[model samples]
Target: MASSEESFLARRIDAEAFPLAVVDVLALAAVLTIGVINHNGVEYLSTNTVGWLLTLVPFLVGWAVAGPLVGAYSAGAAESAKAAVPLAVRAWIPGSIIGFALRASPLFSGGFQWTFGVVVLLTGGVSLAVFRWLFFKLRG
Candidate 1:
């Protein structure tokens, strides 16, 4: 049994969390796009939007599933870089792994390679951590 105050607090947190989640999505898209361009070249993005989407969607789905589970988009998570960076990295590990699994699926054209997976794990974590830090720093 939740009180009216508790319900209102939950609603308020929900309002705040939605926008944060949207920004998280945007940040992830940017990071993933940069990775694509780095590996596949800018022409790949311009010439093959479907390929780009196929490459990108898995990771987005990964984060969409992982972020909330790991509290990456919570109000508390957004409160400071200290909180955000660790949570972002924690979320990113499982998220990127899920992306790799999705990439290996027949629905997407790409297959997972260990070297590429390692690169994604390392760079994606760093990118997300830096992004989270910057997000908090700039917001503050």
Candidate 2:
């Protein structure tokens, strides 16, 4: 009887691991997609190398924020979405700032200025929200 119970528990653990892995993969894909779209649409002041570096800034910052906010890597999928919101907001601020600064660089023909800033802020917020929503759904 004890052996049977242990086997059942192990199966449950394995089931849970699969979903968590899926969530992480989805989150990573979403972030990467956002970066690619933003880079393709926006013109930057730096050379290709600099532009690539700048492109990663927002995604990295957002990921850092989301990881702690949603407890993605540390707390696991069982954490509540409410606990993640503040961290998401904190992450958005810096990501927006960095994105805006990059857009203003003279490497591009015309600086997007306000438009780019708004887009970055919106993108960060939306991305975080979507990620959190998906996380909660999967966890529940």
Per-residue error for 121 in candidate 1, Å, reads 0.9
Please give the distance, in angstroms, between residue 24's alpha carbon in candidate 2 and its true position after superposition.
Answer: 8.9
Report lDDT per candidate. 0.79, 0.52
| Weakest 10 consecutive residues of candidate 1 by summed lDDT | 8-17
* CA deviation > 4 Å runs, candidate 1: 1-14
What TM-score does each of the candidates earn?
0.83, 0.48
Q: State the lDDT of candidate 2 residue by residue for 1-140, as single tens digits.
A: 46986754443333333444355335544564556556664343333545555555544654544443333333333355664444455555765564455545664333556765666567666666677676777667
Candidate 1 clash pair list: none
Clashes of each: 0, 2
Per-residue lDDT of model 1, residues 19-107, tens digit only: 56666777778877998898889999989889888888998899877877777766777567787788778988999989999989987
By lDDT, the best candidate is: 1
